[model samples]
Structures are given as structure tokens and as C-alpha cells.
Target chain A: MKTQKYIVIGGSAGSFKIIIRIIKFLPANFKKTIFLTLHRLKHVRSGFVEALSLKANIPIVEPKDKEIILTGRIYLAPANYHLYIEPTKTISLSTEELVNHSRPSIDLTFQSAAHSLKDNVAGIILSGANRDGAEGLKQIKLNGGFAIVQNPEECQVLTMPTAALKKSQTKNIYSEKQIIEFILNCK
Target chain B: MIKLDDIINFNNAVKEVSSYNLSDYSKKSLGRRIEKILSDYKMTIDSLIKKIKLDSNFLEKIIKNITVNTTELFRDPKIWQSVKYRVLRKLKNKDTINIWHAGCSTGQEIYSMLIILHELGIANKANILATDINTDVIEIAKKGEYIYKFNIEYIENFKQAIQVNPYNYEDKIDVSFTKYFEIDRVKNLMTAKPFLKNKVVFKKYDLVKQDNIFAEKFDIIFCRNVLIYFNAKLQKRVVNMFADVLSKKGFLILGIHESIFGAEALKYIKHGEFYIRR
Candidate 1:
């Protein structure tokens, strides 16, 4: 019943639009667990889970600290916390010092996902204003996981995808629609 | 190229040299922490292996950095609200109340509890034991001060928890932020009021090892955000220890997101976000 082993997605400023678009198309019965980490301002009230759950049929959650990671749902990293995936398949949250000036670091999540899920995972980097997720996607590739980045030209902010291109060992450059296609065919 | 095997071997060496067992920790997060140390010291994996053998302090450096000690004051206000209204409310009539703030890193949670007790008029009748695995954080926790730049979420959480009239609540907590906290605008830091500092007795206690540091059983045990570092087996064992140290009706409060997932979970009944041994 593995739709995909696991999906690790990273984005920053302009990511939700593409993320929502992809979520809109995923089946309610999607089998893989999706972990999303986005850069956000510290102390912003969390409406992220509610907001992402609006059009997405699958269950979306801002996971609690030490919460079990379940399949067939999406887990969003709470603002101002670093999310780490454990080998026991649970998620842990920490208030450890911010990296790259971002607390919900894309690189940290991606890197953790790379090791925990290993080659059975796929790393997707979407639109963002910063270079936070580039090194993370590189980690995914190093661990033999599938690494894909949105085309920089198609991005609202090209810095993130362009940096991923320079930093990560990815050959799959996807556009919004192509990214949707990749997710749909993930099994 | 750094392989997972290399990290595993390093963890094994760490265990052999120092009784610190990291084998159960998630390799990915462990790998990243190791990588961070390597980069910070500008040493390769092999170089780290050599340095680990050559240097005794190297392992402690990794331990200090790797343990997630980062937490803020009044974290997860909803849980605090429950502690006040549900857990503490039950013990309000007691002559004396005792609390164990396990893994009380930097003392934020302990101080927050003291404030609640103060507001409840039980601060004088309370005994608080705050302990952490890291002595460095224990020192800071003893000081009872924190960074001044308050996270807006913290303010919001605090606002929701205080239901009494705002002025009366202020009057109840007469010291206020101004008196208890010496906020330095230029330094952007806040120092704890001496009163709160006096309430807590801090000690260094590791969750991994079994010890009878405190003979008295606690009415409330607040161990939040510390178990995530442990694997399922360790989490189970520690939860049992928490059970051992807690009174029969005493409450075990975990971080809002933390759940007691293993069979040891059967030991307690879930009461909202907390667990109670019935």
C-alpha cells in the first residue's frame, strides 16, 4: 500500500500556491506521508494547517512534539520549530537555534528525511525567496533519494530553485504542472 | 563520502569510549548533528574519529550541542492552562504541593509554574524540584532569566491563560514583568526577578540513567520536549521512571505534541494532553 515511500517538500515565500495546487490533485487516499517545512516569521499564529487543509482532501496537521508520523496524510512543521524525522517513523520538534535565519528550516527537514527515509524517499523543492533548501535537497540525492526542483524560470522567486540547481545533484527539473504529474505518479 | 555506516560506527565508538548510548537515536538527525560538529571544527569524518580518541572533551561537546535544549517561557499555553485549571486546581486545597520539572532546561517551565503557584496563592506552600541532564542549562535555569525579545506567540498564549480581570491579575502578580524582569532595552535581554529564582531548587539529572536523586514523590511531573531525543525503547523506560517518581494520582504532563505511544502507554489514562496513572 505504499503510494510512495515518503515525500519531503521544502519551500519558503512563494511556495503555498504550488503546494496547494499539488495538494488539490492528490487523492484523499494518498498512501505516503508528506512532510512540509516552510520558512516563516517567528511568533506568527498558526493557521497553516487549517489553511492548507482548505482545498486538500487529505488530512493535514501541524504535528505536535513527538507526534507519530502517519501515512496517507500531510504533516506541516509548526512555525518557529525545527522538525526532525526519527528512524522510528515519528516526528520530533525542537526549538533549537534557527539555521539560515529560519526556524522551520527546509534544509534541516530535508536532510533529516534523507537519512530517515533513505532511498525510498523523494525530495521536492518548490518556490522560495532564499537558498535554505538547496543543501537539503543535495543531501537527499546523496542518500539516493529522488531529488527534484521546480524550474527557476517558472518560479515566482527564482533564488531558491536556482540555488537548488547549483547545490543539489538533481536532474529532474519540474514545473508546477510537471511537479503535479510527478506526485500523481509517485507509486 | 560520509556513509550511514560511518555514523553508526562513530556512535558505537562513542558508546565504547563514553557510556553515552546514541545507537537508538534516529541516525538521520544524529548524522546531521555530527556533520554540524565536523563543519564547525573543520574536520572530516576520519579526522573526527582520530580527534574523538585523542580528545576527551570532544564527546561532551557533541552531547552539549546535540541535546535539544532550546525552549521558551510559557511554551504551549493551552497545556499550562490545563495544568492550572485541571491538574493544579485539584491540589489547591492541599497544605503543600510538590512538583518535579524533569529536564527543566533553562528553567522557563519551572518559573512559569512558580508564577502559577504564586497566582494560586500556593507559592509559599510549594516545593519545586527542577533537574536537567545538561549542567550548563541547569546553571542558566538557576539564574531564572531569559532573552528579552518575547515571541509574540508567547504573549498571546499568556494572554489566553489569564482569565481573571487584567488589573487584578496584575495586582495578583504584583512584581509584574517590570519588577521581576530587568529588561535591558539596549542589551535586548530579560533577567528573572529574584522571587522566582528563590522558588526553584535546580539539580543535574539525566533521564537515561536510573537514580534516586529525589526521594519524595511528586504531585506533578512536567517532562516536555525531552523524550523526542530518545528512541522508543528509551522513551518507554523513562516514562516508566516518571511513573515511579509520581504519586498515584499525580499527573504526567508532556509537550503538547508528545504522546506516550508504546505499550507503556497502557500504564496511564489520557487526560486531555496529559497522562494520569489511575
Candidate 2:
């Protein structure tokens, strides 16, 4: 059996457009499971998934706690909750204290993926104003998983990618096009 | 920087030394929480295990810390709104309302329900029982006091769930904070009024244990964010237990971000934010 692949993408601030672009480019049969954790207004819960689903070829889900993880789908960490990837390949949500002033914390999701999936995981940090994903991407690298960052120069807000790059040397610092191509070519 | 092996060893140690069984906790979160404990005590996992074997009091403390006690007043107001209009309204005709706040942390939720019941004129008919594995939180729940400054924002939740009627824009009631709890801003304290505090019976109950010591079926069970900490098997078991303890057509309310899945999902019908026992 082929090893399952998992991709975790963390973004905040100016990363929404980049996420939409990546989703638009992926085909309906994308095999790898994708987890997206973005900073969102906690009170405004209804629109995020609907907006993402409009152009995505694959199913986009805001999973509830302990929901089974499935391939060929995109999971968005719901607002105001931290998302954790379990060794059982299930998603667990927490209303624990916020980390880096955000819930659906990028670091929490990325770290959980790195720990649970190990070498089969890929952690990507995108345009954002904060340093939430820096330590998480570092964990991904330490766990022998792929760690990629959006090229800071190409980002609307460079702080996130720049912080990630400074925390640990990532495998790739790619533009949006390169990022999309890398995902598309994943087995 | 705890490894998976360390977590496993710790879980084994906990189970062997105490009645608590932590093997079914979700690994990632459990690992993270254990890491925090190690850092807090500045001890290695080996030392922690050694301590667990030596002192039962320390073991109790460790278990309390392991269980996440993060809860707030009307943590998700929309669910409480549904409880008011959809759930409690339907139960109004019942001779008595039996409510179980499973895993009730620090008692804000119990008080929240009391306020709602009081507003709905069904306070006298309600019997509320709140439980948690953490004895410290049970004490705090019994006290019904919280940090006023920290929870000042949740006052809005009270307004949203109690004062505003979502279906009718113009239908609104002015409920002062004083009616439910006294806000002593100067002392940084918010204490639940006696009527709300005295109505609830608090107990220390473990969800992982199959025993239902309450010996009574409930009309509503609010487990909320508790199940997110458990692995799938444990979640299924607890959900099944809730199903058994619930009266026919009784409701099992979870956190806004929680849901029932797998074989256990078959036991209840999804009703908006809650599950109805079929």
C-alpha cells in the first residue's frame, strides 16, 4: 500500500487569496488530505467554508471533534478552536486557551500533524502578520517532514514566512505558482 | 519535548498507580498537556512516573491538570439560544426538568442554564446535576464564583442568550447582570446569586468509568467540549453511555465544534446543535 500523504497549511492576515488560488488549481481527484488553519474572526463562523467551497474541486469540511480523517478532502480548522491531528487519523478540536493570540492555531495544527504523521506530512507557512507557524514549521522539519514557506518577497505580508524561515531552514521557499505545482505533483 | 513513548509510559504509570485510565486520551493533545506538566514541575517523565507511584495526592493533582478545565459562561451563545427556544420550550410541559451537566468545569454552564430557566419561568421545575472528574473544579462550581475582569466579556453572551429573541427582532427583554450574579468589579469578582448556586448538586464523576452513580435518566445532558480530549473509542463509549442515561427523546448537547460520529452516531438523531436520543 502507498504511504498516505498529509499537507498542513497555516496562514493569517493576507493569505486567503493565496489559499483560494491553490484550491482553484487542484483537481477534483487530489489524493492527499489537506488541513488549512487560518486566522478568522471567531464570531463570524458561517461564511468561511462556504466561500472556500465555491471554487474548490474537492470537498471542503469544517470538521467536528473526533471526525475521521479522509483523503481527497480539505479540512479547515473552525474558528475559535484549536485543531489537533490524532495518531488515529482523526481530527480533535479544543477550546483551550489561545496561542499566539489566535485559536484554530496554526502552530497547534502544524505541530499535531508533524507529531502524528511524521515523515508523511508537509507543513507550509504562508503570508501572515504573526509568528504562529514558525515553531510549527520547525517541528515539521525536525520530525523529518517537508517544511515549505512562501517566499517572503512575494507575500502581501512577509512576517509569517520570514519568521518561519528564520526559525528553521525550510526545504523550499516557493512562490504561489511553485507551491501549487508542488502540491499537484504529490503522489 | 516529550516523545510518544514517554507519553505511553506516563499513561501506563497513571493507570497502574491510580484509578484513572488515560490511555484513551487523544495522543497529540495528551502529549502537549504532558509536556506542559513536565515543564511546570521541571521534571523528566521518569521522575513524574516515580512521583505518581509514591504519592496518591500528587497523582490526583496530575489527573486534574491533565483534564482540560477551560470553560466559560455561554461559551457559545447560539447553542444556549437553541436551548432556550427549541429545547427548554419543548420540555416546558414536563412535570420536572432533569438536567445533567456532564464534565461541568467551574460551573459557569450550570449557572448559565439556571439563568435561562429562571427567565423562562421554569426554574422551580428544574433539577440540575453537575459533575466533573476534577474535585477542585467541583468545589469551584459549588461556590459559583469567578474572576469578574476575566469574564466581563461573557456578559454579552448572557444578553445574547437570554435578552434577545433571534426570531423576532423587536422581541427583547432587559435582564440586568445583578439578577443572576453580583459583579464586584472593584474586587475583580463575579459571584453567582444564591438562587442559581443553591439549585445545583455538584459531584465528582469520571466519564471514562462505565458506572452511572446518578441512578436517574436525564431530559438534557450537556457534555460540551469534554469529548474533544478523548480518542475515538473513548468518545464512542461516552456517547453510548450518554445515550443510555438519557430519557427517550432526551437531548445530548455538545460544544459547538463537537459532533457524534461512527457507530455511536446511530444512537441519536442530530437536532441542530444537539443530538436527540432515539
Candidate 3:
């Protein structure tokens, strides 16, 4: 059986818009599992999942630990934990020290996916504060996986994505609409 | 007996030193620094001068070796801590935030920021601008990829290296920030994603040469590890440009070792990590 492809999205501050941009482009019938992570306060319940659910026909919900990642389902990391995709496509949670001072670090997700998912991974880093995903994206590209970063000009918060752009090399950088178009068009 | 002629020649040499093309740099400071280098290398002044003059490629190599890239993912942990406590506090209320990565070298720092912001539940609002002088480097930066090497040190200090949060209940996220990476045969070759596509903009810019920036203004300007390349005068000049182009209250972040120092650049402030405001 051909392994399923994983689409991972990570960001902060301006990330909500970034996720919306990509999810909007995905048709309801799309079959890929889309994983989303946005950094926020660990204690506070993020209404983002609900907010995004309104716009996306696909199931948009926070990922539960050990949950088997299903195709066409969108998994969002809960606040304050670095999210990872296991080889079994299960979700792993950690309270370990923060990379870039973030628990649910974008780099953590991207890096883990790059290792576990290999060629089936497509990692995208959006707007954020520091250079978290820069190293993770580098892994994706080295492992022969596709990687993308939002054009900082089009990003709501340019630091995170710009940091990524500064540190690692990427295949392409596109604006929000263009990113959406590319993701949806992907076979 | 003191010779007036010799004293006159010595004075002229001092003036000549000041008049060189590198006058913009503080001679004594840089001279002392280079002298230290010479001493460390156990080379006499004569040999050092000969080494520099005799081989152009060697000179280039020396300069490249000394070039302060001073970079890493989440360079200054305090900066991330500060952003988490201060900037992110405000970010929680906002729907979006835009940031500019100026003088981004291969792209580690920006991705570090994205990881933090994503953890903060604000990744969707991110807008990133990555600019640099080296077109070749910029092209590489756009790839958002890396090769990896696994080291026991990296594994042991993985938590510290990544700055992951240690407090989570219920669905604890277990992304082994270090396990994601494995060592390659090449040294320091990291395998990972640098940034997300559709989240960042990469462009070319020379802070010294450019007078105007046609691109969109930024909410935050990250010129980290870039100012060290220029002399104080050039640093001031670039600082002015950054101030002119930045939005009001926009943040300006520099390298941990770098500072706006004497420049009337931005309203320099000591936040958790060093930051400036226009």
C-alpha cells in the first residue's frame, strides 16, 4: 500500500490566517491528513479549533495523544506542547524543554514528521516570532521531502517564517493564496 | 636624544593609518583585536603582514573565517522567553502579527521564531519577510531544508537545545525535538525544515546600498548578526534605514552581542532579549 502523504502547518501570531488560507483551498473531499499547530498559552483553551471548524468542512479538532491520524482529518496541536507525528501516524505529546522557548514548537512537528514521514511529508512554516522551523524544514528537504515557507511579505508575522528562510533553504516560498493553491492542487 | 624628524615621520604614520579606507572602523579597537589574533596564531607582525599580502585567496579565507555569522535556532533563549512573556501576551489578543527577517543568513533564527509562535497558537497570523545581501545564500535559504547529524550531546541536551515547554497535562505533546534529527556523514549537516511555504517572503537587500525599501513595511525587523559586518558609521546608517522603514512601535531585534549602541537608531530598549522600537 502506498503510504499516505502528510501536510504539516506551523506558525504563531499571524498563523491563524495562514492555516485558514491553506485549509480554505482544500476541498471537503480532499484525502490527505492536514496537521496544524499554532503556539499559544498552554492553560488557556484556544477557541481556534472552533473558529477554524466554521470555515473548514473537514474535521478540524485538537489532536489527542495516541490518536491514529486518519486521512482527510485535520489535527491541531493544543496549546503549550510540541506536537509530533509518529511512524504509526499517532500523536506524541511532550512537556520537554521548549525549542525556541515553545512547547508546541513548529520545529518539533516539522522535524518529527521529516524523520517519520520522510518523502510523504510536506512541511510548511508560516508567520511567527523566532527561528523555530528553520532547522526542521532543513530536515524535510534533506530527507527528500518537500518543504515550503510563506513569503514574509505576505505573512502576518514575518519573524518565524523569515527566520526559517534565513536558516535553511526551501523549494518555494509563496503568498498565502498561492500556498493554498499549491496544497490543494497537490496530488 | 630625541630626533624631531623621526617624531614627525611617526606622527605622519599615525595620520596615514587614520586616513586609510578603513577609517570608519576604530583603529585601536580593531588593531588590538587583530593583534590578539596574531598572538593566538603565534605569528609575528611581519609574517602576518606577509601572509595577508602574499595570498589573496588566503586573505579571503581569513576574512570569511572571521566573519561573524553568530547565528543558531532561537539564538538567545532569553529573547524567546521575553517574547513568550511580553510580545506573545499581546499577540494572544490579536488575530495576526507580521515580522520581517532582515539580513537572514541561511534561516535558522526565523524558523525558531515560527516554532515558538506556532506553539503559542498564533501561527496562522504570522507574516514573515526574509531579506539578505547574498543572492546565492538567499537562494539556499529559500529551500527550507537541512541535513542532520545525531550527536549524544544534542540528544542529552535536546530539551535545552529546543527550549520545549515542560509543563503540559492531559494530551502532552511529545515531539522529540532532537530525535527528529539524525547525523549525516557531513559535519553539522542537519536534516530538517527551515520554514513553512506561504509563510515567509525572501528578498535581496543591501543595508548599506539601498536607500529605499519598496517592499511592505514591517511590524518587527530582525537584523540580527548583520550589523557586525559594518563599521559603526555604517551600522548607524543602516539603523536609520531600519527606523525609517519600520512601523511605529515596530520591534527591531539585533544579535545578542550587537547593540544600536550610540546610534540614534530606534528607541533602543532592553527587553527580555534586546529589542528596539521606532
Candidate 4:
């Protein structure tokens, strides 16, 4: 496999709806890796994966380290782990330390992906608080990757997407459904 | 006297900082910070608002400079390394090990943990909790992918620092980092596909809000490098939040550079780069 193209989705406050919308819009046989970061408590047991899996046309699974990157699989960052891509195209997890008081932090992932994935990637920042992924997304755009942001007016919590749009050169700004279409089309 | 217009700008800045909830923060200090930001950007209050309305990029730049960021990958490697050697042996019989990577950034440290656990053969049996105040970073972290431009030369140094074989792993894979990641043809741009979202449950959380943090306890709350940003009182308060939510005897790994020195914890144990259970 040509190391499935990577799509990163980040959001907070009201990301649940956006994430599901994207999953629903994706083609059943979409051949890319979908990584998502949502805002939730560390200890709460959420049916997020199950919920998304049911709605998504593709298989949704919590990723495992060294698991071969496959096409058509949707992966979520399990609660409390910073998700990173290794040079080997294998998943690398870190227990390092929080950035902006968040683990599966947006900056950490986006910065690493910008450093590793380069132009073969797509980054989207959704409704959220703080400016976490702003710098990372900036790096992504600077690295020739496609950057997108949710229209702030459309977000329940516009801090994140607004911040991203403010700092980086996003290739497109869309509603959740449009974002999914863009990703699918890109693939 | 502070300019009336400046005061308005400061209020706007404060509103932005706390997401329009400046009721809790001190106006004077917040205003000073905002003034500094405005001056640095060479923007008038009117210009600033215009930028916020017309240019989202300017807003992000202001936010990045104003926000406090405390992050490090494998922050306290020793604590994690110890967990691998000492704790794993004792907890081996347990079917699963749930870890909370509290405030996990871009997931670098989380990736390190996953790599270590996978090497330890304990990953399949583990569940990770990656949370952060910045959902932007968390979303990016979920990608599990990174670019290695400036850091490419550090591959050997990173391996040496972490005592892992970066080159050896490449030998097993058919694709080189260059194959999947698109290196900038000109500038130092590098980006790659994320590989870790499959295993993490990323969420946005505000530690200041008790409701945001659930009523459950965790086996390990690896909160590192983030405490330094908050004022001392806030740090203590946040530590209490961790202490309240942590399972008894469960480890709390802080950044190697951070210390719980005089927090409310009964006591702390140092293991490598982290400070563990009380």
C-alpha cells in the first residue's frame, strides 16, 4: 500500500457533531487514514468510537502502535494519549507532557505531521478553545500541506478554527459536510 | 493614565483570552498583556479589531504569543522507562493498563509511550487518555504523523537520547520517510501522515472547570511540562484536580523540569525525569 494518505481532524466544545458529519459524508470505501482529536475528560467512558463507527461508512478503530497504516480505516486518539506519526509510517504514542494542559494536543500532532507528512497530508481545525493547533497548522501550510478550518461563524466554539484561520494559510474554509467532501475529493 | 481606547483593546484581548469570559481574570494585568501584544504587532485597537474581523491569521499570531505553552516529548523519560521496567513486571498479570496522558501535546510523548508499550508488548492491553486545553494540538496529535525536516539530522541524536534504534526500524520497512512525507523542494517544510489516532481518545478539556474533569480516577495521570504556565495558586489548584482524580498509588508523571515540590500531595517519588505518586 502507498501508505494511506493521512487526514487529521481536530475540534473541541462542539466537535462531536462535526466529526460525525464528516464520517457520514465520506465514501464507504474512502482509502485514507482519518485521525480525530476531540475534547473530553480523561476518565469518562464515551461511546464516541462506537457512535462514529456506526455512522461512518468506513471501519473505525482505536489505532495501535506499529500497526500497519491501512486504507479506509478511521482512527481516533484514545483518551489521554498524544498521537504522533513516526518516520516508519507507524503510529508513535507519547506520554511526554501536556502542552497547553492537553495531551492528545493539537500542536504536538500538527507540528509533527507537518514535519513528517509534508504535502501528502490534510489538516483541519474545528470548533475549539485556545490557539493550540494554530502554529502547527501554520507549519503544515508552510510545508506545502493542505490546511482547512471550519468557518468560525458556523462553530459552536469558534476559538480553535478561528485561531487556525488567523495564523495559517488554510486552503479552504467550510462547514463540516463540505470539509468531508474536500477530503474525499482530495483522496 | 491608560488610554481609553487602549482599555477597550485590553478588554477585547481579555475577552479573547478567556473566550469572552474575562470576569475571572484581572483586568489591569490582562490589559497590560493586551497592550504588549498590540504594540508588538504594531497594530492600533481599531486595526486589531479590523484584523480579527478581516484577517484570522493575525488573531492566531496574538493568541500563540499570549498563551502559555509547557510541553516536552518523553518529558521525564526515566519515569516512563521505570514504569516499563519496574511497574510492568508487577502489573503484568493485569489484563489491561489504562493510562491518561493528561495534556498530551501533538502526541509526541504519547507516541513515545505507545512505542515503549508496544516494545514491552503491553500496548494491545492498554487504553490511553490524551487530553488537552488546546483541541487544535490534540486534533493534530491524533494524526500520529510528523515531519522530520530540521529534526532529520537529529535522528541519530534522538536515538541516542532515547536509546532506540531509529535506523534499525527503517531497515524493516520498505518505505523511507521520504516516500510518505513530502519534503519541501525549497524551504525547510516537511509534513507527513499521522499514524496514532487509532489508539487515542482525544478530547478538549479545561482543568479550571471541575465539571470538565469527570468524577473518575485514573491509573496514571502523566501531566508534564504544563504546570509552569499557570500562576502558583493555579498550579496548586490544578494539582489538586489531578490528585482528586488519580487512583490511589497511581503514578503522576510531570515534566522532567517540573516539580510538585510543595503541592498538596502527601509526598512525591522521583523516577527518572518524572515525579511519581504521593
TM-score of chain B only, all predictions?
Answer: 0.89, 0.98, 0.64, 0.68
Candidate 4: regions farther than 4 A off? A1-187, B1-40, B44-65, B68-80, B87-92, B161-195, B213-215, B267-272
Candidate 1 residue-wise lDDT, A66-131, digit = tens: 677888888988887789886678787766678888888998898878877888789899888989
Per model, state how many residue pairs clash. Answer: 2, 0, 129, 82
List the candidate 2 regions with Cα displacement exceeding 4 Å.
A1-4, A154-156, A185-187, B1-5
Provide per-model DockQ scores: 0.54, 0.65, 0.01, 0.03
By TM-score, is 1 or 3 better? 1
User: Model 4: what is its DockQ?
Assistant: 0.03
* Chain A (candidate 3) TM-score to true chain A: 0.92
Q: Per-residue CA lDDT of candidate 4, range B76-189, in tens?
A: 334544665665565556676768887686776677676566556677777788887666677767764455554453233223324533335443323233432356646664
Tens digit of lDDT per residue, candidate 3, span A2-112? Answer: 233788888887787667766766788888888886787543444667888888878986764445788888998766555777676677554334668776788878877
Error of 2 at B261 (Å): 3.4
lDDT of 2: 0.89
**RMSD list, candidates in order:** 3.8, 2.7, 24.0, 21.6
TM-score of chain A of each: 0.95, 0.96, 0.92, 0.91
Interface RMSD of 1: 2.3
**lDDT (Cα, 0-100) at B160 in candidate 1:** 52
Sort the predicted structures by TM-score, highest score first: 2, 1, 4, 3
